[model samples]
Each structure stands twice: as C-alpha cells, then as structure tokens.
Target: MNNRAARVALALICGAVFGFGLSLSGMMNPIRVRGFLDIFGAWDPSLAFVMAGAVGVATVGVRIMRHLSRPVLDTEFHLPAARRIDGRLIGGTALFGIGWGMAGFCPGPALASLPLGLPAVAAFVVTMALGMTVHDRLVVRSK
Candidate 1:
C-alpha cells in the first residue's frame, strides 16, 4: 500500500527467499559448514557452488545498480564510508572468523536456523545478540 509498507513486504520476501535458499543448500547445517571450512580433512565443496552462484548474482546486481542513482526502495544508496583497513577491522574480522569456525554458523545461517527450534541455535543467537550488545556498548564507551 504505502511506500514503507511495500519496502517492508519486499524485505520480508527477500529474507524468506534467502532463508529458504540457505536451508535448501544445507548452509544452515553446522556440519556441512564446518566441512566446507575444513580443507585438510574430509572437506565438502558443495557449498562452493552456492558461494559462486551468490557471487555471480551479486556481481550482476552491482553492475546493474551502477546505472541507478539510488536504490529502488530507498532514496539513497547507503554504503560504508571507510575505505582503509584499520586495526578495528582486522580484529573484528578475526573475531568473526573465529566465531564462525567454532560455531559453524555465521549471522545469516544462525538466524535462518532459528525457525527450526533447536536449543543450540537459540543459544547461538542469544550469545550473538549479547556479543553485539557488548560490542556496541564498548565502542560507545571507547568513543
């Protein structure tokens, strides 16, 4: 109906499609994810195809978006202003990688797994939220 409502509905549809794709591709499976991360041992490469497909799609999307002045839903194309790598970026990336490797689920897949009603997923989500809150508070305090 309204612009905001249409944007919200579009977001919901996009998220649902993303979650369904993650589930269908076993990206929501911790074992499968860990297997993909494991290179020396019995590794699984199935998710590589998924990653490639996603990259391809994103590449095309980026190219297409070049012709547009702003996003379809929003008035402006919001992007990160930071262009240089810093210690904070390095540390955050390392932390994210460590968490992903240890838990076998990044933010996207972890959230997608929430609908499955798994205790482990719930714990991961809770801890993830707590970690995010702690990080935000620490950043604000440091500032």
Candidate 2:
C-alpha cells in the first residue's frame, strides 16, 4: 500500500480497536463512568483498573516508539512540541475534567456512543464541536 493508504488503514484499525475496547470496558455507559468519578458517593473503582491498563499499554508503546527512528507510514514521529505548562494548559485540563465528570463522557467515549442515536449524545457532540471551533478561532488562530 502507498504511504497515505497505509496511514488511513492504520487509523481505521486503531479507531476500531479503541471503540471495541471502550464498549468492552463499559466506558460507553454514562452511569458507569459517573460512578467512577463519584468518589464520595457510590464510587466504582473498576474504571481505575481500566485506566491503569491503558496507561501501562501506552507506557510500553511510548518506549517502543522511542526505539524506532521513524513511524512506518510517516517520515517522522510528528509528536507535539509544546513542553511548557502554562495557565492555558491548566485551564484547558480543568475544563476537560469538569466536563468529563459532569457528563460522564469524554470525547473518545462520546464519539463512540454517537451511533446510539441518543439526544443527549447529539447535544454533547454538537456542543463539543462548537467548543472546539471557538477554541480554534480564539486560541489556536491567535497563537
């Protein structure tokens, strides 16, 4: 396959694997996710295990990537260059965590649940898109 085709195929495969993992881990369920965040209430610790597993895999993946000179389908790693932690980073993270805790749906799981045809999911996706667009125009473009 050509480089572009290989990249597209890899992205699709990765997305499918991610969606399947989310479904199997019950991350697609808002109740379970909210339970995970509710430490003072009826908290569920199972999501912590899932997060740990993901982090462990990511740690190993990063180590493997560090050993590779370049990606299989790319000329370079194309990793993020930003290293400084500023107010914008902290604010963005706080907003993201608040949103996730409130809605029990991060972007990944929210997108994964899009096929369920739920009005809540539709609203979440639309709001998320508007937020992204606003950030792009106000923050990213200004940068």
Candidate 3:
C-alpha cells in the first residue's frame, strides 16, 4: 500500500525471478559451472550467455535508475559511490574467486540447487554460510 512496502515487494519479486532464471539457465549446477571453468577440458560456454545477459540487463537498469529524479520509496538512491580500490576489496574478491573456482558454485547457485539433494552442494552452502557468519563476526568486527 505504501511506497516502502511496494519497493520491498518489488525487490522480493526481482530476487525470485533472478533465482528462477539461474535455475533455468543451469547455473545452479556445479558440474556445469565446473565444465565452464575447465578451459582444457569439456568447456561448457552456456554460462557466458547468462553472464552477458545479466550484465546487459544490469547496465540498462543502472542507466534507468540514474536518470530517475528520485527513488520511488526513498528520498535518495542508495548507490555505492566508492571508486577507490582498497585491500579489503581486493582480498575479498580474490577470496571469492578462489572459492568459486575451487567449488564451482557460488552462494546463489549453491542455495538454488539444494532441492536436488546433492550432498556436495548442501555442504558447500552450509560451509559458505558458516564462513559468512564468521567473517561478519570476526573480520568485520575487527575492522
């Protein structure tokens, strides 16, 4: 009914759509991801199209958002303006890449594929959540 409620609803819908898309695109499969990551092996290039589509959609959405006078729910847009590269940013990105490369599944895909009842996917999701909690409590707190 209110603007904030509408925004929240929209966000939920968007997230559901994204998760569905990831599932539909086979991005939730670690095997598929691993295949894509494997350069010399049986390389699966399907995820490239998914990544490209997402980037295109995000670019357009960002442009549209920037052109808007103000956010529908909030008085100001909550956009990150950090242009400087810092150690935390680099280290976090490297860590994320290493984990993704090693496991062949990121958080979204791991959670999305949990319905398949794969033990590895389940374990990856659980460990990732635990790592996030620990990072939040220790690394974030210490900073």
Candidate 4:
C-alpha cells in the first residue's frame, strides 16, 4: 500500500483499539468519569487504574520506539518539539480540565461515545469542533 493508505490504516486500527479500551474500562461512561473526578464526593478509583495502565504502556512504548531508527509507518516519529510550558499551554490545559470536569468527556471518549447516538455526546463533539476551529483561527490571526 501507499504511504497515505498505510497511515490511514494504522490510524483506523489504533483508534479502534483505543475506543474498545475506553469502553471496556468504563472510561466512556460519563457517570464513572464524573465519579472519578469527584474527589470530595463518592469518588471512583477505577479510572485511575485505567489511566495508570495507559501511562505505563505509553512510557514503555516510547522507550521502545526510541530504540528504533524509524517508525513502522513513517520516516520519523513526529513528536512535539516544544519543551517549555507557556501561557497558551497553561490556558489550554485549564480549559480542557474545566470542560472535562463539567462534561466528564474528553475528546477521545466523547468521539467514541458518538456511536451511542446520545444527544449530549453529539453536542459535545459539535462544540469541541467549534472550539478547535476558533483556536485555529485565533492562532493564525496571531501569527
């Protein structure tokens, strides 16, 4: 297959695996997510395990990938080059935390939940796209 097709195939497979993991781990359930976020209330520690496992696996994967000269599907692993935490990063992180705490749905879980045909999921996805578009426009204008 061609490079673009290979990239698409890899993305599809990875996305399917990620969505399945989220569903299986109960991360796609907003109630569970909200419960995890509720530290002072009836907090659930289940998602913490999921997150820990994800982080551990990602850490190992990155380490292993670093040993490779090139990626399996690309010329190089296009990792982020930035090292400093700027105001934009802080502001974006705060906004993401606020949104996640309020809606109990981050981008990954929100997109995965779309197949359930829930109105809230659909609304969240729509708003997320609008926010992304707005951010892109603002960045372009600033540049």
Candidate 5:
C-alpha cells in the first residue's frame, strides 16, 4: 500500500521470477555450467544464449528507464556513473572469476541450487556469505 511495501513486494516478485527462470533454464546446475565453461572439453554453448537474453533484457530496461522523468516511487533513478578504473574493481572481478571457475557456481546459481540440497552448493553459499561479510567489514572499510 505504501512506498516501502510496494518496493518490498516488487523485490520479492522479481527475485522469485529470477530464481524460477534460473532453475528452469538449467543454470542452477553446476555440471551444466561447468560443461559450458569447459571450452576445450565437451563445451555446451547454451549458457551463452541465457546470458545474451539477460543482457538484451537489461539493455532494453535501462534504455526505457533512462527516458523516464523520474522513478515511479522515488524522486529520481539513482544510477551509478562511475567510470573509474581501479585496482579494487579489477581484483574483485578476478577473484569472482576464479571462484566461479573453480566451483562452477556464481552467487545466483549457488543460491538457486539450495532447493536441491547439495552439500557443495551449501558450502559454497556459506563461504560466499562469509566472504561478503568479511569484505564489507575489512576491505570496504579500509577503502
């Protein structure tokens, strides 16, 4: 009914839809993601389509949102305009890639796979959460 409630409802619906889409598309399966990433092995390129679709949707969404005078429930759209190349950004990206390559699971897929009750997925999620907390407290604070 209120602005906060509307935002929370929208977030929940969006998250549910995203989780459903990930599960339906087989993106939540570590084996499938590993197969896609293994270029020299039995590489499956289907994940490329998934990523392309996401990018396409995001592109359109950003374009439409940019043209709006203001956000529906806010004064303006708070968009990031940072274009600075920094060590923190590069290091974080490399770490993320290395972790994803090793575990065959990104944050989204790791969380989505929780319903399957896989031990490795659970471990990954736990470690990811701990890492996030440490980063926020230590690395982010030092910056």
Candidate 6:
C-alpha cells in the first residue's frame, strides 16, 4: 500500500486497540475514573494498576524502539521537541485537569465512550473539538 494508506491503517488499528484496552480496563467509565481521583472519599485503586501496566508497557516499548535506527513505518519517530514548560503549557494542563476532574473524562476515554451513544459524551466531544479549533487558531497560529 501507499504511504498515506499505511499511515491511515496504522492510526485506525492503534485507535481500535487503545479503545478496546480502555473499555477492558474500565477506564471508559466516568464513574470509575472519578472514583479513582477521589482520594479523600471512596477511592478506587484498580485504575492505578491499569495505569502502572500501561506505563510499564510504554517504558519497555520506548526502550526497545530507541535501539532501532528509525521507525519501521516512518522515516523517524515524531517525538515531542519541546523541553521547557511555559505559561501556555501550565494553563493548558490546568484546564485539562479541571475538565477531567469535573467531567471525569479525558479525551481518550471520552472518545472511547462515544460508541455508547450518550448525549453528554457527544456534547463533550463537540466541545473538545471546538476548544481544539479555538486553541489552534488563537494560540498555535499566534505562536
């Protein structure tokens, strides 16, 4: 297949796998996620294990990939180049944390939960897209 087709196929496969993993780990459930975040209340520790497993897999994967001269499907791994944390980064992170704590749905789990056909999740996704568009136009383009 062509390069574009290969990239699209890889993205789809990766998304499917990620969604399935989130569902299987109960991360798609807002209640479960909120419970995990509620340390002062009836907190759940199950998500901690899930996060640990994900981190472990990622650590190993990154280490293995580091030995390779280049990615199999790409010329190079497009890792983040930014090292300095600026005000924009801090503000964005705070906004994300506030949204996640309030709605109990980060972008990944929110998108994964979209398959359930819930109005709230749909609204969240729409708002997320709008936020991204605004940020892209105002912040990203300005920079």
Best by TM-score: 2
1-143: candidate 2 lDDT, tens digit per residue: 88889889999999999999999999999899999999999999999999999999999999999999998887899889999999989999999999999988999999999999999988999999999999999988997
What residue runs in model 6 are displaced by over 4 Å at the alpha carbon? none
In the range 1-143, model 3's lDDT, one tens digit per residue, is 98878988999997889789998998887789888888898999999999999999999999999899987778988878988999989999999988988998998888878888999988998899899999999987997
The positional error of residue 138 in candidate 3, measured at the CA in angstroms, is 1.8
Q: TM-score per candidate, in order?
A: 0.96, 0.97, 0.87, 0.95, 0.92, 0.93
Global Cα lDDT for candidate 6: 0.93
lDDT of 3: 0.89
The model with the greater lDDT, 2 or 3, is 2
Scored by CA lDDT, what does every candidate get? 0.94, 0.95, 0.89, 0.95, 0.91, 0.93
Model 2, 52: alpha-carbon shift in Å? 0.3
Candidate number that wins on lDDT, 3 or 5: 5
- Give the runs in model 2 whose Cα sits over 4 Å from its true position: none
- Residue 16's lDDT within candidate 2 is 97
Report backbone clashes per prediction: 0, 0, 0, 0, 0, 0
Query: Over 4 Å off in model 5, which ranges?
Result: none
Look at candidate 4 and give me any clashing residue pairs. none
lDDT of 6 by residue, 1-143 (tens): 99889989999999999999999999988899899999999999999999999999999999999999998788988899999999978998999988988888999999999989999999999999999999899988987
Q: Write the per-residue lDDT of candidate 4 for residues 105-133, one digit (tens) a residue.
A: 99999999999999999999999999999
Q: Report the Cα lDDT for residue 141, model 2.
A: 94
lDDT of 1 at 141: 79
Model 6 TM-score, all chains together: 0.93
Q: What are the per-residue Cα lDDT tens digits for candidate 5 across 1-143? A: 99999999998998999999999888888788888889999999999999999999999999999889998878888977988879978998999988888898999989988988989999999999999999899987998
Model 1 accuracy (lDDT, Cα): 0.94
